[model samples]
Target: MTRRILLFGATGYTGGLVARALLERGEVPVLVGRDRAALDRRAAEIRPSDPPYTMVLDVHDVGTLRRTISADDVIVTTVGPFHSHGRTVAEAAAEAGASYIDSAGEPPFIRWTFEKLGTRAANRGARILPGFGNEYVTGQLAGAWALERAAEMGVPHRLEIGYFSTGGSLCSLSRGTIASLAGSSLERSYTYRNGIRAERPGARSSSFRIGGRKYSGFSIGTTEHLTLPEVSPSLQELDVYLGWFGKASPLLATASLAGPLIRRLPGAKRVVSTVGARLGGFGKDGPESHERDRSGVLVSARVFSKSKHKLSEITLAGPNGYELTASLMAWAATVESHASTRSVHRRTGVLGAIQAYGLGVVRDTCLHLDVREVESAVVSA
Candidate 1:
């Protein structure tokens, strides 16, 4: 069956990689964007330029986008700042009866998107899976694996997810990421502790080491904390930290502290795009610099249960942060497409990619792509 996918933001960096990945996998999705010239350039690069189709329409032009994607087609949207475009795209997709997915950066945005659109999607049988990118999917999947192992051993309690990378940011972060950064007015952190969600002041001493390298990691904007309720309602506490191999610790630390302040600036939104574009790529120095982040996820959990078992570990490692993100987003679209076609009624309502796709499926795919599994183990009681 032909999977009719309407790809929004097809001309952007993440969009380009996702489109390429889709083409490589032998799928021709209808590319949609507001820029005719950029869309033309992207289409020319695809294997068969004339495979499907491309449309230049603003996402806010709900009338056009709504009618265009108003069908059973899957809507793969990479446009973000999600606070801005998320509702427009999600609402359009839901009304159109299209399965929706995107790479949202912040938790509040993810929460808002799902809360506002979740019911519509469920009612319409559409999948509104956000954070399908590196931010949450890989980490969440790894956490899921660790929790499953803990459950098997009868000691599941707390999950701590740490991301260490030899590569850089996974997907193409756009102006929206910059805007999110620029608009930050206060220092903040989210944690799920003992089955309760709480916000706290950004903590110091967020530094830790993995693989013998001293990496300084702090809580940046991520949904891992938000997803705990969905993944494991019984989770006692879930913490996610970002570790940088080298000097990035200082920049990351500064970003964490200043993010909220900068976000509140009057002109911050205008410069967010520029900052994100400049800071998007990885530095050539490798592993240490925030410029070129090497991708690695270390998930360690302390399980408190009826059994004597207490510790569980799982890691989903990969290379080429940007490339991997592109691959992941495309893969997510593929899963949603396939699931939609098969009428899989497993569950709906802001479902996670790994939960939607299953570990065996992701594990096999990772193996094929040579994304190694460094460790998947459980500490016995």
Candidate 2:
């Protein structure tokens, strides 16, 4: 079995961006998707590299997916609303002992990966990671930074990692993203409560006025609430919030009210979900680099000790969502590829970016994100 990466959903919007980033960096992955022509065109568009091996299959087509990968290969998937489509790919990768990574953000699905799929992947000698992209990595970096700073304190500690995305006025998402959020609205948001994975039902809200901007935060389901605890096991509490929604609180509140119905009535959900397709990447274009720069997330994490001491604070302004996701998947894939087989084999089971690559590499490799730590000034890595 040859060592390589099988990039699933290479034809989708975020997937295409990952493909280009990979190609631009003089790397290649076996592009996988349901559309053969689109995959071929994408392969052709990339710079000269190893002839791409393409696989066409639906997100749930695990039987066929198994035949396309090997133990030495790693699967990087972008085909999501992960709650609906992530399990199959994860299962197939675990069964085959093929390493796996995904751009999954939905908390329900991410919790499913770490709690349910972690053992499965490990049993088969595979290393699986969810939320390796925009949805969680930036937050993970902030958390990891705090932990490292506290480690510098040289004391026993119980800490907390709070994740919130600050701004995105010019930011917009694809129909796919909107649809995912709409679907996840019905699924129970999850977190590690009292050192255990627990379901956080209903919508959790946050209100804060910072940097001359008012934030009405929405807990729209994210993996960070779960994964960050594993990264820093001493972390006693974790809250993941979304202030980037800005004025959309009323609409989200309505969704919260309708969540019970969405779970029970399929038709009602269908009608509401049309908003996702309309508002997402359907007809509207995504933001460009400059536009994204003007509107990126401020991932702020405060580090505290068991005695309620504020040890240190970590802050990072990540790149645009789409670009951040693409860069992360590409960079993680590249890191896994260059790593020794023994190193990979030792990393079996679901892991976060901090656990998989460490904060040093995450900060170093994701150069596009600007990071600032307390008393540290602006450091590149």
The most accurate candidate by lDDT is 2
Clashing pairs in 2: 174-280, 174-281, 175-280, 175-281
How many clashes in each candidate?
A: 24, 4
Q: What does candidate 1's lDDT look like per residue over 189-289, in tens digits? A: 45666643535223433543445455455554455665544655666767676653345655655545655566578766557654553554332211232
lDDT against the true structure, per candidate, is 0.62, 0.69
Residues 1-381, candidate 2: write the lDDT tens digits. Answer: 236988888877788888887776667788988888988887877644555777777877767777766678878898877877788888888788877889887777887887788887787877788888776888778777777787677442543333335445523666567777776676777544556444434356655444444455565445666566665666776656665566676456545866775678757656655666567755654555565565555566666677877787665665567787888888778766766666544667788877777778778876644434433244221
lDDT of model number 1: 0.62
lDDT of 1 at 210: 45
- Prediction 2 global C-alpha lDDT: 0.69
Q: Model 1, residue 19: displacement in angstroms?
A: 0.8
